[model samples]
Target: MQEWWRSAVIYQVYPRSYQDSDGDGIGDLAGITSRLDHIAALGVDCIWLSPIFASPQADMGYDVSDYLAVDPIFGNLAAFDTLITEAHARGLKVITDQVLSHTSDKHEWFQQSRKDRDNDKADWYVWADPLPDGSPPTNWHSHFGGPAWEFDPGRGQYYLHHFLASQPDLNYHNPDVVDAILETCKFWLDRGLDGFRLDTVNYFFHDHELRSNPPAQTRPQVMATDLYGMQKNIYNKTRPENLGFLERLRTLTNQYKDIMMVGEVGEMGNRSIEIMGEYTAGEHRLHMAYSFAMLGPDFNAEHFRNCIEGFQRGAPDGHPYWSFSNHDVPRQVSRWAEHSVSEDAMARLSCAMLMSFEGTIGIYQGEELGQTETEMEFEELTDPPAIRYWPNVKGRDGCRTPMVWEKDQPNAGFSTGKPWLPVKAPQAAKAVDQQTDDGIMAFYKEMIAYRKNSPVLSRGKTTFIDQPEPILAFTRKADAEAMTFVFNLSKDTQEIPMQAEAEIAKGNFAQIKDGTLTLEGNGYVYLSHTGKAPI
Candidate 1:
C-alpha cells in the first residue's frame, strides 16, 4: 500500500520564530505545543520542525552540537517529548530537520576528531593536509564564502566544511560514523517521531581522492548567489557513495511502522530533481525528497510545470514533497511580487496552486497569513551570510522573522521580550486577528479543506493540459470525478478558452459565452466537468 506521505500535506515550522511560551524572545517546544491548534486547523497531516537539537546557534540550529540532546535555548528533551506526544494526540505527525552532512565544531565527535590525529574519533571528520604553498587542498568554495577547507591549528591540518567553517563535514566513509548516525535515528524513532527531513543529503559523502572540482562549462544557473556557482561542484559533494548511506538510513527507518524519511537535496535547478529521483527511487532509500527549485523567485507557468513534470520524468514511482516558502528564502508572496495582482491575491493563489500539485505539500509557518519578508537593516542582521555579504545578499533572516498571531500583542505574541528579529508594523498589520474572515488566512483554511474533500484533487492522476504562456492548465482525474485547474501567473489579464460545456467549479470565476473565459491579472479558476470529461 502507498504511504500516507504520498498524499499528505506537511507544515514546516521554524521553531525559533514560531512562538514563545516563556517570553524568552526565542520560540521553543512549548510554544509549538500551544500553537498546535493553529496548525491542525490548517488541515495539514504532519508538521516538520527545523533543528531543535543542542547547538551554539552559530548558524542558528543548523550547526548541531549534540545529536541526542535538545538545546537549552529551545528547550529540554522532556519538552520535545511532550511536543511529540501532544502533536500525536492532536492527530498530527511530526518530522524534524536532521543535519547529517556535518557537525558543529562543538560536537563531541568533532571536538575529539580535532584533538590531534590517531585517536579513536580522529577519522570521524573529513580532514586533509595543505598544499606545498600552505593553500587549501582543493579549489572548491564553501556555500557561504571562501574555500571549503578550514585550517585547524589543533590538528595542524585542514578540515572540509561545505558551508560555514564552524560546521565541519562528517566523514561518512568511516563505518563507525555511519553506525553512530543510525543509532541517533533510532533514538528519535524510539521516541515516536514520525520521520526526519535530512538536511543536505547529497553532501553526506565526498570523493576520497580529494580531487579539485572542475570549472563550470556553462554559465551556472545562479540563484542570487555567486558562491559555489562558478565551479561544477563535482568532487566536493553529491558523490556516488552517498547513495549507500541513504540506503542504510532507510533501512533503519523501515524498522518502525509507517516511518517516513524526506531528504533536502541542495542542488540547483533540475539537478535537484535528479537527486530527488535517485535518493527516493527505491524502498531502501528516502520515502520522499524536496529541493529548492520552487523555493526561489521563479513563478512562470513553464517553470512551475517543469518542476513537477521534471520529477515525474526522472522517477515515475518516486514520491516528492513540495513547498514554495521555508526558513531559507524570501516569502513567496513578496518574492513573486512582480507577478502578484496583490499580496492578498498572491498568497491565496499560491496556496491553491501548491495544493493542486501531485505530491505532498508543506506550508511554512506564517505563510497562511500571507507574511511578507521583513525589511531588516544591517544592525538588525543575525545571519552570518547577511553580515558578510551585506547589501549584495539581503540574507535569509528577513524571511525567518517571528510569526505574528495577534496584532496588539507584544511581538505579535511571539515573545514577551524583544524578538530575535524585530517585528515590523507591515507584518504585524497582517496578523491573525486582523485576518479572521474573508482574508488570506481564511482562504488558506478553506483551500486546505477543499483539498481534503475533493476526490480528484486528493487522490487523482495529474495530466498536463497545454495552455499559453503565464497560464498553467492541468487536469486531475479520479474514480468518479475530473477537475481542471487554470491560473494566470502574470500581472495582465488573459482570455482563457474552454469547451462550452465546461462549468466553473472552484474559486470565483465569471464565465463568458462562446467558450471564452476572462481571468483578471493573477486570477485562477478550478473547474469541474459538466460534459464528457477527458481522462
Candidate 2:
C-alpha cells in the first residue's frame, strides 16, 4: 500500500461544534457519524478528530482522565467504534488527538501520584520539591497564565503543568510512564485507528535537572502572555530525551499497516520549524510534523517562504503539514482581514496558497464557507484562557463556535437545542445549504479536486520565485511536468513579469496576455508551463 498520509488532504473536526445528535446542545460521536457524508463529499482523504478521549472538559478534552474510555457525553466506546467503521466505509482514514504530554489532574495516575511519594504512580508525573523558601522548583511560566507549577500540599512538592494547572505534564523521564502511554496508544491501534495527531508532542519531556530557562534574546511582539514570551523556553520543554520516545512511538506505529502520525511541535517562531525537523527527520520519528509558524499572522510572501524553506533546510528528511486555521487559533479570514479584498476572496486565496505549498495540507471545518471567528462576550466565554485574560487575550473560543449547516435552522442545524457555542449572524450567513455554485464552498471544492487530480500539486518540489511584495510566486516541478503558481496577497492589483510558454491550468483574477501577469486582490493562478522553473 502507498503512504496515503504523505500527500493526503486532512479535514479537522472539532467534536463539540461539528454536530449534536442528543438534543443536549453538545456534539457527540453519533453526530460525527451522521455527518460523514458531508465530509466525504468534500473529497478529503482523512478526518482528524480533535480530542474525544474521556476528560473533565478542562482545556476542552486536552486533559485526559481516561485513555481507555470515551467520554459519556460524547458517547460510549461502541459509538466511537461505529464512527471508525463508518468513516472507513467511506474510504476516509480516521485519526485522533493523542494528548500524551499531560493528563487531567483527576486522572487516576495523577491522583495517586499526588497522594503520596511512595505510591506506584508517584513518579508518573513531573514532581519537584519546593525551593528553600517554598516556591516552585524553577521559574517556568504556564502557557495559559501564572506559574507552570502547582503546589500539592499532600506531596509537599510542585508538579509541572505546561498548559492549565489541571493538565499535569507527564514524566517521560520514567520508563514505566512511557510504557503505559504506549499501551494506551496500542489499544486504539488494535481497535483499527488509522493514526494520531499528537498534541503538544514536544512537551513530552522536561529538563531532569530543573533548571530555569534563560530570557528570550528578543521579546517577540506577537507574544500574548506576559512572562512566557520573555523567556527563550530552553529548559521546560523540547528536551532532547523526547526524540527517543518519538522513535519508540514510531516503532510501535510501524508494526501496523499504513498507519501515520503527525506531531504538533508546540514551540512558536523559527524554533518551531527546527523542532518539526528534528521530530520527523527520519523513519524513526514522526511520519510528519507541523509547527505554528504558518498558523500565525504572517501574510506576506517572505514570511511564508522563510517558514517552508527553513523547514526544508532544517529537516530535509522530514515531511511537513500545512494549515491556516485550527481549534486553537483565530480563524484566518478574520485574522488577515486587512490584507484581503473580502472574506470569500480571502478564503479562496488561503485555500489555493495552502494547496500549492510542498507538504501535506489540512483544512479546518467551516473554512469552505469562509467562516469568520465568532465575536464573543465575557459572559458567553467558556474557554479557560479567555476567562482568565479577558480583553488582552481574546482567547480561542471565537474559533470553536458551532458549524453552520442550514441558514434558517435554529443553531444553524448543528443541534436542535441551544448550541455550546452560539451561531451568530456572521457565521450563520455562510451556511452550507445556502451556498451556490459561485460561492466559497464551491470554490473550495473545485480547488481541492484540482489539487487531488494534479500530480504536480501532490508530489511536486517547489522552487521559490523572487517577486516584489504582494506578489507571491513559485514553481512546482515533478518528473516531466512543471507548473507555475502566483498569488496576489493584497487588496490592490499587482503586476509582475512572467516567462513561460503555458496555458492557464486553473485560476482567478490573473492573465498572461503580454509577457506580464496581472493578479487582482486575493487572486491566484496555476499555470501548466513548459521549460525550466518559471521566474
Candidate 3:
C-alpha cells in the first residue's frame, strides 16, 4: 500500500458551509465540485469532508440515517461521484467523515432494535433493562446533557446514546453489528474514496458490564458546557474493546491501496497522548490519530512542548496528525484571543508551526484567509447544544458558520439567501477576494507551496529546543539541511538566543540579522543552519 497520507497536508471541508451552488442556504456536493479549483490552488494533498450521508441534520450530519446513500440536502450519489472524479483529476485525494460509533435514531438498525426484545436486531444497539428503582442501568452522562440512556416506550428498555437521544450508540460487542459496519465502509471504499476521518474514534466501544463510571478525583470549577467533563468517564468511553474494533477497521481498509484512516480522539490533557499512542502504535491499527492537544486554547511554550513531547514519548513509533482548528471548536485566532497579533501574522505563524512539525497536518477551511469565529446572537442560533446551554456556552454554531469566499459580496459569497449561521463583519473583512493581492491568503498559498517544495518541511525529523515561557523552538532536519523554527506565543516581543552563525532561511519575522533573534509578539522565524546543525 502506498503511504501517501504521511507528509500530506489535508484541508477539511464542512459540506454544509463550504459553498452553496444552488442558493438553497446550504452547501452541497455540486458546490464542493465547483470549488475544487480553489482547493487545488491552495496546494492541499487531500480534502476531508464532513458527513454528506443521508441524515436528519440533528447533529448536522453527525447523526447519519443512511450509510450508503447521500442526503438530498447535500446532493445525490451522482454528485459525489463527480466530486471524487474532479478531485482526482486535480491530483487531490478525497476523504469523507465516517460516523460508525453511532447512527441516527432514524437508522433502520436502530429502529428495529428498539421495536422489541425478540427482534432480529434487538442486540444491535446497546440496550439494557432499568434498575429496581426504574432508573437507568448506569450513571453515564451524555455529551449533550442528562443521562446517556434513553427509554424507548415500545421496547420498555433503555438504550445508550453518547450524544443526543437522536443518536443511539451501536453495540460493537455484537459481531453482526461489526459485520454491518464493515459492509457499510466497503460500500464507500468500492466507490473510490481515498480514506475516512473517523469521528469520535475512541468512543466506538463501551464496557460490556454496564459499570458505573467512577467520579473524577479532582474537579475544577467549570461552567463551560455543563458537567459532562466532571467525571472520569472511564466506563462511558475509551474502553479497551475499541482497540480491537480499530484493528478490524484497519484490516478492512488495508485491503485497498493508498487507503488511510485518521481517528479523532477527544481525550484531554496527558490522557490524550496515551490514547493516541495506543491507537496508532502499530501498522495493524489506525494509520494516524489526532487528539485535542493542539485544538484547545493553550498557546504557551510549556503547553505546546508538553503536547508534542508527550506524543513523542507515548507514540515512539506511531504517526500522529496535528490540527489547530476544526468544525467543532472555535477558530484558533479567537480562542487564543489574548495574543495581540494581527490575523494575517497569526495565520502565517500557525501554518508555519503546524507544517514544521514531524507529522501530517490538517487545516480547516477559511483558515487560509485568517477567518475568526462569527459573533452571533442567540436568536440566530441553530446548534442544539448552544440553544440548550445558552448564556454560559456560545455553542459551535459560531465556528461552523458558512465559509466566506468573495469580499464585498452578499453573504461574503457563501450563500445567496441568509446563511445557516450569520457571518460576522470581522470574518467577512478577511474574505478571499479582499486578501488575494498581498495578505494572509496569498501568504498561506505561498507557505503551502513552500512546504510542498522543501524537503525539510515536508518530510523531516523534528528536534525540540528547551526554551523559556512564550518561546517555542524546534528543528526539522532531512539529509544535510536543518531548518530551525522559533515561535513567540505572547503579545510581547521575545528574543531567542542563537549562535552568530545561524542564518535565517524562510519566515515572516522582521529582526533576523542579529544574533539575538527578535519575534514581535506571536511572530515566528525559520532558520537554516550555516554551521553544523544542532543534534
Candidate 4:
C-alpha cells in the first residue's frame, strides 16, 4: 500500500488557541471539531495537534500527567473521539503530540518514584545520588534554565529534568518504563489515532555515567537567557540508545496500517540535520523527522540549500518534515521580515517555497492568514523560557496568541470570553473573514491547489542550481516529469539567465523577458520542458 504521509501536507492546530466552545477563554476539542472545515478547505492531508493530554499546564501540556486521559481544559475523551471522527470524515488524518520523554511531577508514576528508592515505580524516572556536597549529579543545564537535575528529599537523590522541575524526564533505560510508554502509545493507536509527533525524540536517554558536557566551541552574539546552548550538550540528549526506542516505536506503529511517526529532533545547527538523518535513516525507525534548522532566523538561500542538501547526503533513505512555523517558535513572517518588502509578500512566498520542497510539509495555524507575531508585555507571558529571561527573550506566547477568525466578533470569534492571550490589532487585522479576498490568502489557496495538481512539486527529488545571491534555483524530477523552481529571496529584484531549454511551466508573480527570468522581490516561478502546463 502507498504511504499516505510521504507527500502529505499537514496543518498544525495549537488546540488552546484554535477555538473555544465553552467560552472559558481556552480553546477546546469541540471547538476544533467545529472548525474542521477551515482545515479541510486548505487542501491538507493531515492535522498534527499539539498535546491535549492531561497535564498541569506547567509547560503548556508538554508535561503530561496522564498520557491516556484528555485534559478537561481541552474537553474529555468523548470530545476527543468526536474530533477524530469528524476529522476523518473530512479526509484528514490525525497525528497527536506524544510527550514520551517526560511526565508531569504530578503523574502517578512520578509520585510513586519519588516516594522511596524501592517503590514499584522507583526506577521509572532518571534519579541519581547527589554529589559529595549535595549538589546536582552533573553539570548539565536545563533547556528552560538552571541545572537539569532536581532534588527529591524523600528519595535522598536528584532526578533529571531537561525542562521544568515540575516535569521529570522518564528513565528510558529501564525496561519497565519503555514497556509502559509503549503501552501508552498502543492505547492511543488502538483508539484510532493515525500517528504521533514524538516530542523531544532525541532526549529519551541521558548518559549513564553522568558526564558533564563540554563548553560550546562558539557563543551567540546575544547571550540567551539559558546558557544551555553555551555547552555541547552531549551528556543530556541525542544518545545512541534513542535509536533503539524509536525502533520499538516503529515496531508498535507497524501493527497498524499506514501509521506514521514523525520525530522532533531537538538539536541546533548542522548537528540537527545529522540527527534527523540518524533517526529517520531506515524503514525500522521514525517515518520522518524535523529539526529547528528552518524554524530559526536563518532565511538566506545558502542556509536553505545546506539544510536540504545536508539531509540528502546524510540519510539517503530518510524522509524529512519541513515546517517554517509552529507553536514553539515565533511565526516566520516576523522572523524573516528584514528580507521581504511586505509581510503579505513574505507570507505568500513562504507557502510557495515550503510546498515546493520534496517531503512532508506542515502549515501552522494562523500562518495562512499572514498572521504576524503578537507583541506581548512581560506580564502577558506564559512560556517558561520567556518568563525567566523577560525583556531580552520574548516567549512563544507572541506566536501562540489566539487564532483570529472574525474581525467584528468579540475576541475575533476565537472565544466568547477573553482569550488567554490578547489578539492585538496587527494580528486581528488579518482575521479570516477580513482575508476572504485578501491577496495573501488567495495566493495560499492557489499555491496549495497548484502543488496538489502538480506531481513534480510534491514527490520529486531535488537538485539545486548554483545562482547569484538572493536567487535560489532548483530542479525537481520524478520519472519523466521534471520542473525547475526559482525564487528571489530578498526585497530587491533579481535577474537570472534562463536555461536555454527551460520554459515557463507554471509561475506566479514573475516574468520572462529577453532570455532572462525577472523575479521581483519575493517572486517565484516553476519551469518545465514539456507541453502546456497543467497548473
Model number with the top TM-score? 2
Better by lDDT, candidate 3 or 1: 1
Residue range 215-273, candidate 3, lDDT tens digits: 77686538755466777889978999998988888999989989989999978888998
lDDT of each: 0.88, 0.91, 0.87, 0.90
- Candidate ranking (lDDT, best to worst): 2, 4, 1, 3
- Candidate 2 wrong stretches, greater than 4 Å: 220-224
Regions of model 1 farther than 4 Å from truth = 220-225, 509-512, 530-535
Summarize candidate 1's per-residue lDDT along 1-535 as a digit string, tens digits. Answer: 8578888889999999999888779999999999999899888899999999999999999999999999997889899999999999999999999999998999999988999899999999999999999998889898888889999888889999988999999999999999999899899999999999999999999999999988886856455447588898888888999999998888888789988888999988888998899888967888999999999888988998988899988988888889999999999999999888788888878988998988888888889999999999999999998898888889999999999988998888789988999999999998888886788888888888888778787778887878879888888889878888888888888887656456677664345456777778878888888454321
Candidate 3 regions with alpha-carbon error over 4 angstroms: 530-535
Model 2 poorest ten-residue lDDT run? 217-226
Off by over 4 Å in 4: 531-535
List the lowest-lDDT window of 10 residues for candidate 3. 526-535
TM-score of each: 0.97, 0.98, 0.97, 0.97
Worst 10 residues of 1 by lDDT: 505-514
Query: What's the TM for model 2?
Result: 0.98
Work out how many backbone clashes candidate 1 has. Answer: 0
